[model samples]
Target: MSGIKLICGKELDRVFRDRKMIFSVFFLPVIIMVGIMSLVGNLSNNAQKDVEAHTSIVYIQNSPVGFPQFLKAADKDCKIYEMSDWEKATEMIKNGDADLLIKFPENFVDMVSGYKQGDVIPQIKTYYNPSEDYSRAAYDTISTGVLEAYRQSLLSQRVDNMEGLTVFTVNSDNPDMVIQDEEKAGGKILGMMLPYFVTILLFAGAMGIGTDMVAGEKERGTMASLLVSPIKRSSIVLGKVIALMIISGVSSVIYVGALVAFMPQMIGGADLGMNLTLNPKQIAMLAVLLVAIAFLYSAIIVLVSVFARTTKEASSYVMPVYMLILVLGMTTMFTTKTPGEWVYAVPIYNTSLALQGILTQEVTTMQYGITLGMTLVFGAVLIGVIGKAFESEKVMSI
Candidate 1:
């Protein structure tokens, strides 16, 4: 026990005392999170602003005498193009030269007046590309203006002629929506992101310390000094794993903290902390899972680095592993539904799914148990593999 503590203290002091370590572990992740969020927020705001500022040009086919004025009054910035060739105007709208096209049937005004006088109402076609945001905006605005005019005309005639009288009035009561489990805007965003966020931070933390402890020591000819010490190899491995876990855990926590603080502000109308819910068991299980993830990643990194000749070689080997982790972490981002019961047993896949479920407040205790149990088993297996590597004298040769 004392030997393990001795190695743990030495490694911890070596890492925490270094200025480079402090900057990399602490400040760098914060900088990355802030920079990425700023860029996304700026780009989204700019795109929406551009869509809103664009003016729609309307191409009218066979418009009545006073119809153009009504169109202009509804959208003051609109420019009306009267095209006698209906096909040409439609082609213009399709080709993106015009934002909207309005076509009126023959005798548009007479038919409308006739309809108001108890004749069948004719259909007016409003055309715009639904895929284009600007076109959709134009369609909605123009349609609203036309529909409002039609409705007012109908009601005005009813009151003036006293022909139709309404006994019941429509009373709009904006009722509350009831849901089984409600997720806030912020919780949704955080749930999707937390898996990836923690994965990246854990990898970052592992990459530095794992390579330095194994490959760096090999490169510096310092592994011999540690190998000669009269201590159990398992204890040495344990101490290193524990120290790596601490460093990596700290890095990830820093990232999660920054994300939680900024997420609500970054995502409009989001209340992450205020509206979030997690059962005590779920929280405890999640914490356990995180610690287990740290251990698993650290053990794998150290095992790989232990075989490398130098820090550069260790980095080369870990790059693909990091990439794999990234690809796996992103699997839950778009999924609207949680994974099935059986999937929670898969290692990294389970972590992402558990996080998704937890954030959305949808996970069951059994699912958390499955994830936590599987994680412990995986970490234990890795510890055994790494312990054997430590015992083998040839492993230090690289």
Candidate 2:
């Protein structure tokens, strides 16, 4: 026990005492996360504002006498032009020279006024480039605002009473008709994304320093010093794994903290309906789950580091496992429904599932139990394997 403690203390001190390691592990992530998110948010908000303030250029063929008045009324900045040929106008829209092209049938107003029961209705055709932001915005505004209002006016003239056309209204004035589950609704957007980020960051935290700890030492010919010490092989392995787990766990917390703190502010004027709030019990469960995940990640990294001949070799071997972890975390990002209970028996994947459930306040005790138990079991087994590897003198001497 004393030997294990000594090894653990030495490893921890080595990391903490290094200024470069402290800055890279603890502070660099915070700076990059906040800087990137803030820059993206500013750019997005600027683009939206530019779109809103842009003046739309529209071409209309065979428009009714007063249709231009309606277009100008809806959007004062809309520049309307009369076009005899539509092919030229369509090409202009596609080429970004114009925002929209609308073709109204010849004598459209007369046809609507003279329409009878069971007669074919007049069709209005519109063209715009969906890839162009200005064209798409102009189409949406004209379709919903100007065109809808014109249709309603024509219908009112045809009917004796407009109220006769209405059958029923669906919660028109009362928005409280929704049975709001505040618990699940609060963190809806954040919940979907949080698990994926947490899972990836936790593993990344371990991967950063893990390879160099063992494999790097071997390459530098310093691992011999540890092997010759008056310490059991298992004790050395345990101490190193524990120290790595603690460092990675703290690193993961810093990452998660930065995300939670800056994410809302980073969105600026936009609202994603995110309102994450956790109860004490949920917070406790999350902490324990994160610790277990960190421990598992530490064990795997150490095992890989132990077997590799150099830091580069360890990194190459770790890449496949890193990709697997990335895929597992991404599964929860788009998954709307939870899987069967037995799925919790899986190791890294279960951590993502459990995290999603915990955020949404939907995780069951059994699910948590299965995931936690399986993770700890895998971590222990990996640690044991690493200990056995350490005992093989031929493996270490190389």
Candidate 3:
């Protein structure tokens, strides 16, 4: 145990003493995260403002007597044009010269006013390019604002009471009607985004430092000297693994912290509702799960680093593993279906799933146990295998 601690301290000292390594691993990520995300948020806000300020060019065919007046009153930015030629209007809309085209049936007002129980109904048709943001916005504004208001006016003219039409309303402007865990709301949002990033970062952090630790040492012939020392092989493996885990864990924490701190500002200052009120148990579970992920990732990276003869070869070998981790992590983002409990036993994917579950406060004890136990068990087996590899005279001497 003392030997392991000594070697671990030495490994940590080597990294900490180097100022370049410290800045690159810890500080650069914060700068990048802030710079990139702030740019994206500003762009998004500017685009939204531009779209809202745009004047929509609208062509109305067979306009009702008060329809144009209603439209102009509702939307000051609507540029109303009366055009009877359908083909010209269609061409104008398709050419991006116009944002919307609306055609009302002849005698639309008369049809509504003189409607009987079994009469023909008048339908209004709208044409717009769905691909164009301005066109789509125009359509939505007209449909919900002008057309809906006009329809309501007609309904009032025909019926004595409009309230009879609504059978029931959900929530009905009552805030108390909605049942939600406000504390867990942010968890859902984080669950969707954080799991994938956490999985990727854990492995990426391990890969970045792990490759140069063991494989680089071998390439530089430091492994030969270390092998000749009085220290046991298991202590070397444990020491290196512990050091790698600590460095990668701290790196992952910094990265994730930057993301959380910068994300809200990057999204135009929108309220993320990330109210975290975690109890002691939840915090403990989260810590355990994160430790498990870091350990598992460190072991895998070290295993690959040990098998390879050079840092470049180790990097090449770790690429496929990184890709696999990426794919597994993304499953949390795209997958909506609830997975079976057995899924919790799977290594890379389960950690992501478990992290999501923990964040959302929906993970069962059984599921958490399965994921944590399997990950640690796998990590331990990998450490044992790496220890044996360290013992191989042919493997390390090369």
Candidate 4:
């Protein structure tokens, strides 16, 4: 035990002494997270701005008496266009030269003027490309506006004659208990996003130190000298594993802290409206899950590092594991439906889902046992492999 502590302290001291290692393992992640999130937020805001700034162009054919005036009154910014025929209008819309096409019968106003309350209503046809943003926008604005304006016109014609229409709207749900729109929006965003970032950071922190500890040492011959010393092979492996776990776990915590502190500012800039809140117990459980998962990731990375003869080879091997973690972590963010309960026992994904639940106010106490227990079990198996590798000259080759 003393040997393990001594060797562990030596490894930790060596790592802490290097300023570059400290910055790369801890600070770099925070910087990248902030930069990427800010870029995403900016791009998103730009797209929405473009959508709102857009103006629709309309093509009129056999124009109704008051439809054009109604459209102009509804949105004065609309650009009115005239086409030779339906064929020209279709071609114009198809070529993106126009956004929407409206056609009306020459006598359409006379029909509306003579109609009874229950008579067959005149029909108007409108066309717009569903794929074109301008076309869709024009259709939505002009169609709804023209309909309302025409209704008001008909209503005015009968204003003094009758009072047959009566309309009332009813509500059923309790306003106090139902979730707000912003809260639902915040829920989906937080539930999916938190898991993706945390899991990737966990894997990244472990990969950086784990590869350097065992594989870098093996390549440089330090591991061989250490193995040949008075210390037991188990003690050496245990010391190294402990150092890796602590370093990677601490680095992961730093990453999480930086994310929680600065991400909202970078991503949303102020009062993000995310409405994300976690109680004390939930946060404590989240820390427990994160620590256990981080240890598990470190053990797996160390196991891979032990098998490789050099840091480069270890990195090559670790890349796939990183990719796997990314895919699994993204399951929550990219997937339309959260994975089922049975998935929570499946190692990497379980941690991500549990983290999502914790942040989104949906986690249960049973999740702590399931996620922590399975992750520990997975980590133990990897630790056993590392110990066995310490006993093998071929695998731990200098």
Query: Can you give the TM-score per candidate against the true fold?
Result: 0.82, 0.95, 0.92, 0.87
How much lDDT does candidate 3 score? 0.87
lDDT of each residue in 1-398, candidate 4, tens digit only? 99999989998998899999888878888898888887887777666667567777888777766667777887778788765678877988898878888776667778777877797787777888888777877787778876667777777785764334536434646567656666445655777777888888888887877898888988888877888899998888778888877887787788877876676666745445677556688778877887788778888888888878889999999999899989999987766575566777899888888887776666566775788889989988888888988897777664
Q: Order the candidate numbers by TM-score, best to worst.
A: 2, 3, 4, 1
Task: State the local distance difference test value for candidate 1.
Answer: 0.78
- lDDT value for model 2: 0.88
What lDDT score goes with residue 278 in model 1? 62
Each candidate's lDDT (Cα)? 0.78, 0.88, 0.87, 0.79
lDDT of 3 by residue, 1-398 (tens): 98899899998998889999898777876687678878888888888888789999999988889888888889976899998788988998888899999889998888988888899999999889988888988988887677888888888878898899878988778977768898788888878888887887778777878998889988988888988899999999999999999988887788777777778787777666887666888779877888888998999999999988889999999999999899999988876888899999999899889888888888999999999999999999999999999999877875
Give the clashing residue pairs of candidate 2, or none. Answer: none
Q: Rank the candidates by lDDT, best first.
A: 2, 3, 4, 1
**Candidate 3, superposed: residue stretches over 4 Å from native:** 164-173
Candidate 2 accuracy as TM-score? 0.95
Q: After superposition, how far is residue 103 of candidate 2 from its true place, in Å?
A: 1.0
The CA root-mean-square deviation of candidate 2, after full C-alpha superposition on the true structure, stands at 1.6
TM-score of 3: 0.92
Q: Which candidate is the best by TM-score?
A: 2
**With candidate 2 superimposed using the best TM-score fit, by how many Å does residue 279's alpha carbon deviate from the native?**
1.2
In angstroms, give how far residue 250 of model 1 lies from its true place. Answer: 1.0
